[model samples]
Target: SMICMNHLKVGHYINFGLARGLGSIAYATTAFSLGLLVDKINPSLLVLFFVVGMVLLLVDLYTIEEIAINSDAKTDTHISVFKFIKTYRFYFVILLGFGITFGASAMLSTYLINIVKSLGGTTSFYGIAVFAMAASELPFMAITHTLLKHFKSEQLFVVAGIMYLVRNLLICLAPNLPILILGMLSQGASYGLFTATITYYVSDHIDRKHEMMGQTMISMMSTGLGSFMGNVMGGLLQDCFGLSIMLIAGLIMTLIGSLILVVFSLKQLKTHAS
Candidate 1:
């Protein structure tokens, strides 16, 4: 879904934005139709659909120019992940920051419904909050590359942090349904910015020979370690303290992580100038 963004003439962020926005529309349409069709459709036919989809994806993959052009045909006999990490400590540090940021985001996502309910939101309002966040991604993603042209990726990360800060604060203190939903708008500015750009940044900084490995490490950081920690820590904090305090904790972590990235970005700029 993401790697092919590197191949677009329109630019990675723009390509990703269009891809995700259209994907969201298709997903929503498919989900709604699936809901309606589930009762009438035979279970075995669903498996057939899944197999056909996989086959189509495989065929599509073979047609992508980037896959043909960018991939190595020769297999590596002795690839060492640890040696790569040792050599690219700088990239790892930035990835560490990404992990923390994503961890906090996961915390927010994990408990959003509970926070909404605490603010006196009904089931309908909860649905609205979720829908608004998802729906908002389309337009924001459409403009993400435009925003990137005006700001550094790290600067955009800071913007994402600020949005997240606003979101967590509002969720922590919101007294009514509307305010809580308003906080949900930050989803577009936060994840819509960071998630779309992180891969591009990694690709730019890492050597082409190890590009895929670097991306795998990033995936582990953001989704594997970060998500796991977020789920456990978020749940524990919510259980021990409350949703409000858990969000506050997440806010603090996010700020620290963003600051780390900002420092790294500035350092890179300085090094480049010299």
Candidate 2:
């Protein structure tokens, strides 16, 4: 997914947001269908269904252009990934902020079922919560361009970071199922803003030739490394303190990360002023 995003040279934000929303809708629909079929159909058939879906997906992907042509389409000298990292340290800081946002979100996602159970929610409630959280992305993403018109991507990134903090705080303070579900709905703002803007942010900062590596780096942070750390640390926190405490930890992490971006924004503003 990250690799594909770099190749997109059109209205990138719109394309990204629409794709993400559609993908989330597909995911939610699949979950709902599987829930309905769990009792009526054999589990093994689900594997066949997935294979069919993948084959169809491959057929579609075969139509897309591998490399997008742009003004800077000229080939450049290749550098190893290690050298690229050492050369572009600032990108890593931005990625780390996103990592914290995603890490906290991943922690919530990992233990969502348990959290629902703790709140006296049923299995149906769990499925509904997941659907709502994902489906919430649809409307926000559909209007993402409108959002960008009113707010800079950097400001939106800060909004996303703050929403990440807010979502965790809501979860931490949730006294009942309804409040927790509200927190779940907040994923629209938190997740939507981050996913929609991150690619554009990287595109603006990194060279066109290094597009693939740049997107890959962000993906590794948000989805790969961040998720891994969140799962491990969240489990430890849960074990040591409680699930609620883990949410508090998430709140703090998000705040610190968001603050970094806030400071960065301020510095940029001051530089412009000078």
Tell me the tens digit of each residue's lDDT in model 2 across 1-274.
4544555555433366777788889888898888789668888878888899999989988986566555655767476778888888655666787788678778888888888998899888999999988998877676665677677666776677677777777776788999998888888888876777766666666777776788788778888988998899999999999987898878877777777656665565456669
Best by TM-score: 2
Candidate 1 structure quality by residue, lDDT tens digits, 1-274? 3356456523432466657766665654554555456668765766776889899999988986563335544666344778778878767777787788778878877787787777766655665676676766677676766777787776676666567667666665678877877777777777666666666666566666676777788788888988998889999998898776787888887777777766786676668779
Worst 10 residues of 1 by lDDT: 5-14
lDDT of 2 at 237: 95
Clashes (candidate 2): 0
Q: Model 1 clash pairs?
A: none
RMSD per model, one decimal: 4.2, 2.8
lDDT of 2 at 191: 81
Models 1 onward score TM values of 0.77, 0.87
